[model samples]
Target: MDKVNRFIQFNDESVETRKLLLYERIAQALSNTPYMKVTERQLIEYQPKEATLAISVFWRHRTEEVTNLGRLSDIYLLSAGFYRQFDLTAWRTFTTDIKPHSYPKLARQLLMLLEEFRMMESIQKSRAGTQRAFKVRRDIYAEFHRDRLLSNAQRGFLADALINQLYLDIHIGMTSSPHDVFDRLPIDRVRQVAQRIFETETTSQSASLAFQIIALVEEFLTGDIVLPLYTFGEAFEDGKPMKQSSKAMESEEQGESDVKETIEEEFRTWHRETEEEKGMHLEFDLQHGTEGASDASDSKPGNEDAEVQSFGTGRSEGNEKEIGAQPEIEQQQDQSVEPTLQAGSDYGHAHTQVTFKVMEVANKTDTSSLSTLSAWRINHLPIVRALVTEMKKRLERKRQYKRENLTKGRLSSKLTTMLTDERPKPFYRKQAPSPELDAVFGLLVDGSASMIDKLAETKEAVVLFHDVLRELNVTHEIASYYEDTFEASKEQQPNFFEVMHSFDENRVDSGPAIMNFEAHEDNRDGFAIRWMANQLGNRPEHHKFLLVFSDGEPSAFGYDRNGIIDTAEAVWETEKRGISVVHLFLSSQQPTEDQRELFATMFGNKTASSDSVEEFASQTLRILRKLLAIAVQ
Candidate 1:
């Protein structure tokens, strides 16, 4: 029986990815700004200043259509209703002036609801199709608010009860209060002031009218509001409301600084684009030595072919020569290190603040080692042949179909044409041979000291992967990575990647290099995965896969605590760039619950743990088959 990963989830990542991208597109379209981004939050809100649309988590349990429509309603309110119609500056001024009210919270909630009512009226008038969605919204909110009003009124929470009643009054035209004891309240005065809400056009007018209703009902609204019945999208850029004196001082000090730095706006928030535009991307050439050197401050690096250096036990004399003949600045550095600002700045949580010097080790194994090749072939020949056969079958099936009804091509014979005297439109075309997967693969093997026991199984699995892909003539790269603990520091860490086989070199004799894999000092899984992903990003393939073979989690200098978060972020970033990452855990014993959870957090469901060499090999083949299936489809 084939070994299957028990923790494997059947949910398709591709579909979820596509759905997220589609939601972003929808937000962009609705907001009429390409910069709009959609994220999940506890309540629905749209920050126009930040160009972020947040959908509520409460819609998750609803049906797909209802949930989508609910999100659309929120976006429509914030985009069309408030963003374009409401006057934010005027609203701020009104709030600043009316700071000393008996029931400030109640007054704020009343203004928010009135403004929403105004925007909803405008939205329904302009977009007739949105009326149906709003009706559904009304039906859902009405049921909840009706029950809430009764509960709050019975408990003497008059402020909360009043807001709920007001929401139901305007939303569904329900006039009666839930209880008779609450009939002594000033309902007639509140209704009279609410009548002017439709005639008011701006937010300032809405606020002025809401305060009038608040003044009459101030006696009953003695307590603070527990929860708001409605939400107005976040309009204030500053988190807190500015005091009157601070607002005046800010107005007085506008543009007072002589030194002003301006940042160009972009439609998307990609840091890589900023680097390219600012010419911060560095290019170091290793092939022609110092002759191709670029000035760190002046040269616009051209697109040139330069081989990454090799280090560790696999390092060769040629590699040393390439590493030594660099401009003094480039000798010790294997990868580009970004310059950091000395002054403190808020770089945010997503920044890893780590740099790497990637050096690729050259393969030095002699092809004359027949014993190594014979040993691997003798033990894994059947599995290799089986994988190749199954892959070729899928590839052929994907390529063998034909287009039956073409306007111009070789003539086709049809009896119906003669019997019905139809126009002789009988042409067909053979479907062109589909490209082979249109994908590129990168295999990263961990060479940490902990892998000493599992090295043999890791090699066996890698050899099987190599033999099958080589037989199918697919493009791939295989490398082993480890971090040099002695050279690690706060500024930079040296990472060595030994390439057994690269995309350009698909030699059959490279199997000896695979057998020469060694256990090194430590593993920086995040840095290694990120560096490999950067390599794969440059390839011209639609589908990219990066498979990591490791024995445990990341363990390097000062990286133990935050290594999991960094690795997970790297995986998330790679997948966003259209790369699929899978992790294979090889150990002598089964993984514990904590170990399984750690791997899940880092790789999601794209991971498999194996305790034996045979199981590891089987899991590798299973993952490859699934990936190929996705590619062929």
Candidate 2:
């Protein structure tokens, strides 16, 4: 086999573009609107009915330079945690304006949003602490490739940032609404600027890397490319049984036809070339008038000296035309033989290397066998599944290894047997933790008039988080919002209401909250979120986090009776206590003055607002983690 023989054809331009698109789509799917499950983080694409939240809302990561599914997912989650970065207020204004038959609303909205985004971009630049942390975080992300898992602490770091910092003043300076975030900036124009900056930055790394990439792509498209060859899936197509008759028959005929012509042509060409080479060798010997000699003639037969024969063997000649003619003919023979030997050696070496490589691929049968490969080559559970699918694919690969070799090398029989053995090993079967229970801490929902819709999704989160937490045997307490003058002072950390935080110890907490709409405010910060954070803060060393299930406005918290300034003071006090808050915007439609105020006060820029309860959970959890990340370390 020659270097030319070890070639594989692939289309580059279309193929690379297709691959790049595939990668981009994967990013889209993972970062799509709505929420994906904790398990579905890497497996981002989903049918609408499969989830309660929009994929975009739930996904909390952004586009990355690399395309590793896992890394992209993390980055996606990171972005999803801060989904407000790419504000769609401009688009939102476009729609709202269309409804009103007014372009001014749209124009103002776009202008405001563009200003906000520009501010955000500037904020990103000015914030040295955030940039330093992000740089450190990028380094930690590289560790994830090696470790395959971000420690709880590392995840907490990201969550903490999202919860505490609004991604470095990207939303600072002027007050802005969702419609004002990205409205002003022309998307095409902005993209052009970004593209130019990137082009300038990337040009310095390698001037020809882009061109090399293009060249490699063109070679594939034109069918003028070659790749190293190795054996794979040989036992699959020929050895595996087909599940369906139609597929079996169709593939059977196709496989037979294709393999027959291909193998025949290939083998015939190889054999013809080989014979031609052998004949040439014999011809050169005869041309030198070297008659057939006994096997014992080259050196002492069956002796060490026989192996010592040099490259330029003296040609047999007698009574030549002249002395010069004899030496010249010998020189010609040397020239011819050396080049032939060189060509033969090159082919021979390649064949040997390829054979070994072919044998190196594993023959996996099922998930269990795939587990072993994952244990060796990977660390993520998601990657293990991909390997299993690829291993099970029934394709016929040429057996370039485990065959005859023209040269002899050391025989490491033990190693050969070890590698060739096909054994199954189960993966993703991580044993649950002992007792499998985390500590207990339940949420207090605001069952006020405005919070009714918000509670549905909040209740669902309670159930899900409870189920997972309970399985881990973590004890918890449940509480809900209800204001009363009967409770004590803000510094004293008064209870929301009488008996609002009680639940069956043996069961998961799902107790009803005591709503106090008639009481001071609507029970927002005055009692609900304020009281709950204080409660969680009291119990330390448990992964205790609070999900402030509210539209977050303090209007419901009776500012008239208790004074709005006091409510604001309570919010700051809660923050000082290290209680993380995840705001779940129940319904942005007809938002109360209170809801709008609360949404801005608590969530800042990355607020989670959804029309549907179910759809809200996926995004809520992502936001929860990001919010919690700030408090973790």
Candidate 3:
């Protein structure tokens, strides 16, 4: 029976994964932002700065399509419509005015609740497809709040009951309170104001209405809000509106009290299911003499008195300049434009606390390094030449086309008779003899410790990639990445991308610098891909390609559970920006079926497996040929 239950649980998880993938694609399309992602949380919230759209998991029990679609539509409306139109300055002013009121939290919840109606009305009028989903939402909420209204009124929580009554009236045309317990309250005036929810067009206008209603009803309230179930998300603090907090804000209402005691009390009084209602709590602390204390000591190779660097939500000057503006696709128009990178935008939520440092290869000009480069170049010169020849032939074939009758081009000797006869079309043009490939490439070589034995062959393949691109006059960047696992801790993990060649140094003779590459501690594939994609997205080339060379394993500090999913998401986001990604699996013998399947899931079908050095070189050339062909075409 236990095995059978486990099988059922696995199937349920599989279905959820597939559903989340589909929803993510929908979010990317609807938001018109390539980096926009959908995730599951306790409530429907939109974090614009993080580019995350979270749907409430409470409604997951409703397996009907209408309920699911309505939930997704709610996130879409929050992300695309309300986030842009809401006025943060006005909201802050309102919150300050009501901060000392008897029902400050209830007043804030009322404002959010009213804003939803206004936003839904505004967004649904613009998008026709959202109509049915919203109808489902209205029907479901109408039923749920009817029961909540009766319960709150019976407990003498007038303000909370009033909120429920207002919601029912606005959405479902309910009149008066459910029980006649609010005879002294100004129900008629409140309903008159709530009726204007459909009339208000902006969040500021909704705030005005909410303020008026709270003024008339605050004196009748007694305690804190019975259940702040109508919140959109966390209120804006510190001026960065719609940004996500790294710490969980869902536990704030419960304070720092005993979790079990608080939950038990709420259950006994309200008969409420508050367990899943409260989202996950996260805490970070610095501990001394823990399990892995030696790993954090300076006895490691590079951790001797090193300075601790910090990564924050704010963008650095360099990051801003690197992620400058580009063309954005119009959401309403049917056109094909490459996705743009907003300044300081992150592709996925992983590695939010991680910092990346771009470094040059160490000891590049040292005597031993120079000697190694010279000998290495001598050993691999033959294969590099051969690969260059094969790639150039393919590129030339793609560039083979001619125009015999052109008005303005190089004069052809064969068409001289037409010119003599005073014909208008006498000139002919052939393709440029040495045309530039309208493409840029980024090669991210894995620097994990697992690559130690394969470093020699890997360098050969990399040198071939670099030398050929140089021969063809194409712009490309080659770098290796790794994390210092020995020195890593919970609060901070530093990743490095050591550059052997950059696009700006295309004219320089740095081919020998490729010999300085070495295997390092660990590899975080998703973070590395995202960093490289950010660099490549700034280029003006028409075609962009990112090639990753690894053994299809992503291992790093605190990256075990979501490593594969995050890597796949990074690949999807990069491709959405019109950059093609291909993976090459390096191994000695043939890869097992599991390995191949893993690579396929992460990289899609654009993957190649190499069994030896010769096969690696050949596969690298083949991938380049395909990319160049796409570029020329």
Q: What tens-digit string does per-residue lDDT give for candidate 3 at 553-609? A: 678888765676678878887999999999998876677666676677778898899
lDDT of 2 at 105: 29
lDDT of 2 by residue, 123-194 (tens): 346543234433433344434322321232244332222111121212221122211222332322323232
**RMSD for each model, in Å, please?**
10.9, 37.1, 15.9
Query: What does candidate 1 score on TM?
Result: 0.61
In Å, residue 335's CA in model 2 sits off its true spot by 99
- Clash list (residue pairs), candidate 1: 309-360, 310-360, 310-361
What's the lDDT for all of these models?
A: 0.68, 0.34, 0.70
Model 2: ten consecutive residues of lowest lDDT: 352-361
Error (Å) of candidate 1 at residue 131 is: 2.5
Give the Å shift of residue 390 in candidate 1.
7.4
Sort all candidates by lDDT, best to worst. Answer: 3, 1, 2
Model 2 segments more than 4 A misplaced: 1-442, 452-458, 484-521, 556-558, 561-568, 588-598, 602-607, 624-633
Return whichever of 2 and 3 wins on lDDT: 3
